[model samples]
Target: MKLLWLQGLACGGNTQSFLCAENPSVSEVLEGFEILFAPSITWDRYEEEVVFHVLKEEVELDVFILEGAVGDTRRICRRDFEDVVRELAHRARYVIALGNCAVFGNIPARYSREVKGLQFRFEKRGGFLGEGFTSRAGYPVINLSGCPAHPSWLSYVLLKILNGKRLELDDLGRPKELYAHLTHHGCTRNEYFEWKVEAEELGRKEGCLFYYFGCRGPMTHSSCNRILWNGVNSKTRAGMPCVGCTEYDFPRENMFKTEHAMGVPEELPLGVSKRGYILISGIAKTFAPERLKKRLIDEG
Candidate 1:
């Protein structure tokens, strides 16, 4: 298997995460798979060699992984990333959409309606792959969504492929194994959330950032909290909100303003009804302790 990893209109956070993989390291799992290109790591090997410029008849790529928000225009590739992605999608045996930008028109597509994630544009509401696009291998695009995807998720997927385990994907094209867990699942701050104790401010140690800090742990789907980052903690655990970076609407209306409107988020939990959500929130709020509600300005 020859893997060709490409990028466009991105800060390359996915590449950074991929390099930080803990288990086998990217090289270990991708040992057998010849790397056609990987900008960060393969620069030593392919910097002088232009794989894309080579003759098509001389090239063979089995897996194509794209990490960035791509569109019909270009800041990197000669043509729009859409053309490059479409061409690669047709050529590769497996195509993986590497991050939120690649999977769902992340931040780059937020303001530029013309610019979009690989498959969909924000304004258009879908990608170049359209509503019914599948690879030649009969598999849909493999999506790993995140502002910067977790390294474990990427490594695990590659290992599964190497072991010949069939992958099961959700309707959104994300592997069920990784996206199955919500960001809130197994969160260390679950107790705070249950009690509806909103952290009065950042750096607090005893409250859920979701209520007032706009943590989207409840609605977003990802194993961020379950797996934990840097092996010890996650954003919520450190008093920062989840930011819902894994979901489509990251940097949503305002990056700093909490997502509460009249004391409630505009959106409810994943697949949760507003009525039920409000009821649960109410119950949790009632039981909040006075210490949690009090101004802890002097505590620290």
Candidate 2:
């Protein structure tokens, strides 16, 4: 497969994440595909010409992966990146939006009036590529969404595509295998969450972040805990809130503080009703285990 990776309004965090893949190893994974152009890995400006040529249909484009938001032409340079993206997307056999910015116009779109994602802007469809756009394979943009998408998720999707397997994407175009489960699944803080124990501050290692720290693990769709970031830990495991980075409405207000209504969280877990959450939480808190309430470490 001939792969071309392009970047628009981005910080290059996704490229860094891809470089850190461990299970299959970055080199091993790259060996499988023919990399036509990747600006981050190679400091070559002329590669854009090759991409331009590919867009013109002079060469076959097996896969076209876009990172970052598709900014407006007026605000940018003489060349319109969105135009190039639209053209290349139609020519490629497969189109993959490699991060939240590319898939949902993430942080960049928050302030920019003209920036948009490849296929969707936040939850709304009709972005740079429009809602009707589809790759030659008859598939919409395969979104690997995150602040900086997990390396494993990118590799997994690529492997599946290379093997000629049909992907099952969610309503937002994310692979079901990576986005079906909540970030809370397989989390180490499940006990504390169930018992409504709140972590007053960061790095306490004994309480759930949901109650006070605004962890969105229970509501966000991600395999962060199950697959583990860097094959060892997730944001919640490392004492940080989930932040719902994978969701379209990421970077929500008051990230450190959970929004509540009458002392109850405004957003409960996926299927748990407000009344049901209150009922279960009350019972669980009343019978909380003594072991879980105390600090895991002994400072004395």
Candidate 3:
């Protein structure tokens, strides 16, 4: 299980989040895997000799992980990081894009054309790696997208790989085991959403954050709620809106305000029809069980 992790225009958030893994944790998972290199952890760019070996592909690798968008890291021993990533992809069996930046050419990509995701730039294919590119293992670049991808995501995939399992991937190259569920799945405010009870403000334990507060729980795909962050709570559980960090078009302009088409949400939940939503929302609101209207805590 030889692994090499590289970074480009990165914030290092994914590594930070990956360290928070409780289910097996980073150190535990790293046991079976030989870390040939990683920018923040096992390796740093200043180590010219190791970087040389990795770049030259002298050491055969099993997995190649890119932490941020593929950008000009500007002369890692007179070699561009983009060139390094493109070259390393050919040497490794499996290639993984470890965060939204690495998968979708996120925020940094907004500024420079040089910055691009491994296989996609936002909604479009053909990023740093073109549309037809695949790993030595014959798989496309697997994306584990998030502002900072959930630690469990990497840990889970690594465990599966270590166990020699045949993994399934979505069209966007994300692992099906992780991205199959919506952010709404198992959300604490689901009851409020079912009854069309929308939160009027940012922090409240009672209502759903979808309608007025711009929570993308309904439309965005992720297992955040199902796979709890830090093992206890999520954005909605703490009464903050789900900013839809997992989607292709994350960090939209109106992240905190719902975009509506004449009082109807512009983006309805995945597979939910607008007419049906209106009809259900109306009925649910009209007969909204008296219990839903009150605060969750009885402060008598």
Candidate 4:
């Protein structure tokens, strides 16, 4: 299949991360799909030549992948990047939004009215492309949402398409198989969270970052802990809070501090009612195990 990749306003983190896919491996992916254009890797004098033919219907676009948000700031296809995305989306069989920027308009949309995601901006449905837009395959932009989406997730989607597997998607246009689970799943600190033990600081091996710290693992949908990054580590596992980069409400202020209302967390876990959270948390804190209460070894 022929794949054409494009970018708008971004740092190219997703491109860099996509190259690090260990399971499929970058070479394997390159071999499986004919990458017509990948800005980071393939840049010719007439860089966007394939793109022009694809737009003019001279070349067929099997898959169209956009790595960043679209906006008026960047020029492509004569005027703006959005113009190309809007046109190419109709010709491409499958359209993909490869990162938080392209899916939810992360940093770029936050600053300008012109910058926005493909189909949705933040929690709103209308973006650079209208909410009603769909590709030639009759699918909305398949979002692999993350600050820099996991390489395996992108590779998984590609492989699934290659194998002709049915991709069941959630309401958010993300594959249900991937986004159905929260980042909290398979976390090493689940026991600590279950017992209401909060990590006083970052990188404590035993404590959960959800309570005192602004860990969005409980609510954010991702397989970060399950699939793992670089096949080994994740942000929370490394003692950093999940910044909730995948969700629409990203770039939130004071990410390290959790917001509370009357001694209860303002952002409860997904599907957990506020009252339920309050009650369960109260009980869990009261009966937390002694083994978890004390540090295993004195660091003095």
Candidate 5:
């Protein structure tokens, strides 16, 4: 397969993440395809005219992987990038939006009106590519969304695509294998969450971050806990909140504090109703285990 990677308004965080992939390793993944263009690694190897020729359809493009926001403030620059992206997307058999920026215009989208994702802006449908757009394979944009998406997740998706397997995607175009479960699904603090034990401080290891801290694990869809970052631990496991980075409304305000209404959480878990959450929480707290309420170890 001939693979091309492009960037627009980005910080290259996803590229760093991809480079750090451990399970299959970056070289192993790249060995399966012909890398036509990768700005970070291959830009020096090829001339600008070569890239222009590829963009002009002089070469076959099997997979188009975009890793940043597309439209920016400059009308001419944005138009040029959009034109190239559209042409490549139309020619490629598969189109993959590699990170939150390319998938949903992430943090960059907040700064400029022109900055937009390849296929969707945040939760909105239309972006640089129309909502009805699809690649030559008849697949919608395959979104691997995150501030810096998990490395293994990227490798896994690529492996599946390489094997010619049809990926089942969620409504937002994320692969079901990676985004089907909530970030909290296998969280280590699940016991504390069940008992409504709030983590009073940033580094406490014995409490849930949902009650007080803005841990969006229960609602944010991603297999962070299940797959584990770096093949060992996740943010929630390391005493950090799940900031809902994979979701469209990421980088929300008050990341360390939960938003509440009348002492109840403003957003409950995926299907739990407000009344049910309140009732269940009340009952759970009333019957909270004695061991869970105390510190895990004594401080000298």
Candidate 6:
């Protein structure tokens, strides 16, 4: 299981997230397999004197994980990253994209004129592994997307590989095991959502933050509430709005404001109809309880 982990124009938060893995000391767990190299832990660079065993000796790869956005400039390190990604991608049995930046070009690529995400830019949609960029080994690139992907998501993917289970990936190449559900699933504030109890304040414990605070739990994918972060809580459970970090166009303009042209959302569910959505929302709100509408002064 020789693996290579590479980073491009990244902030290294994913690295930190990987290092903080609690399910297993990720390093110790992965030690059962050989690691060809890692950017942060390895001392190799363009100027380094380490022997390129993989390139020179023809070392086959088991997995390749790419992080960060791939720049669009002709003179930038994007080429270097792309070269390594392509070379390793073609040679590896699997490729894993470990963040939103790599999956859909997160924040930097949002409004930037040039830089693009690993496999896509905003308007372009398809990224480095172009619309047709597929692995020579027959497996598609695995995308683990999140602004900062939850640690467990990474570990679970690696473990699944170790156990030889078939990973069910989505259209975007994300694992269905982790992203098949929305962040709102199993949220403690679900009752408020069902009752249409909008939270007027930022940290209210008794109301849903989606209707007013731009929480995208209704639209965004991920199991934040179902799995529970750090084993005890999640964004919605702790009174923080679900920022829709798992989605591609996260950190949109005036993020606090919901994406609505009038009173209806501009973006509906994955493929749901606007009319059906409005009808269900209307019915849900109509059955709202007065007690849920009333604000609770003491959470305790």
User: Clashes per prediction?
Assistant: 4, 0, 0, 0, 0, 3
lDDT of each: 0.76, 0.87, 0.86, 0.86, 0.86, 0.75
lDDT of model 5, residue 124? 95
lDDT of 1 at 278: 89
Report the poorest 10 consecutive residues by lDDT, candidate 4: 39-48
lDDT of 4 by residue, 63-168 (tens): 8899888886566658566777788888888899999999989898888887888888888887877889888778888999999999988888888877777788
lDDT of 1 by residue, 10-49 (tens): 8899999888877677778788787767878776665224
TM-score versus the correct structure, for each prediction: 0.88, 0.95, 0.96, 0.95, 0.95, 0.86
Model 2 weakest 10-residue run by lDDT: 72-81
Query: Would you list the clashing residue pairs of candidate 4?
Result: none
Q: Which tens-of-lDDT digit does each residue in 72-131 have in candidate 2?
A: 632223357777777778888999999999999988899986898999999999888889
- Of candidate 1, the 10-residue stretch with the lowest lDDT total is 47-56
The top-ranked prediction according to lDDT is 2
Report the error of model 2 at residue 60, Å. 0.8
Q: Candidate 5 lDDT (Cα, whole model)? A: 0.86
Could you tell me which residue pairs clash in candidate 1? 119-127, 119-128, 120-126, 120-127
Relative to the true structure, candidate 2 has a C-alpha RMSD (angstroms) of 1.8
User: Model 6 segments beyond 4 Å from truth?
Assistant: 39-51, 72-79, 111-114, 123-125, 259-262, 268-273, 277-280, 295-300
Estimate the lDDT of model 3.
0.86
lDDT for each residue of candidate 3 in 1-300, tens digit (9 for 90 to 100): 899887877899998998788868788988999887766667444546666877665688899899888876666757776777788898888999999999998888888887889999999998888999989888899899998899999998888888888889998999999998989998989989999988867787888988889898887778999989999999989999989888889878978888888889998998999899999999999988888888879878
User: What is the per-residue lDDT of model 5 for residues 1-300, given as tens digits with 9 covering 90 to 100?
Assistant: 888887778889898899888868998988889887776767555534555778555688888889988885323223476777788798888999988999999899998778888889989997788899989888999999998898887788788878999899999999998999999999999999998888878887889999888899999988889978788999999999999989888879899888899999898888999889999999999998989978889785
lDDT of candidate 2 vs native?
0.87
- Lowest summed lDDT over 10 consecutive residues: which window, candidate 6? 43-52
Query: Candidate 1, which segments miss by more than 4 Å at Cα?
Result: 53-55, 72-81, 122-126, 259-262, 289-300
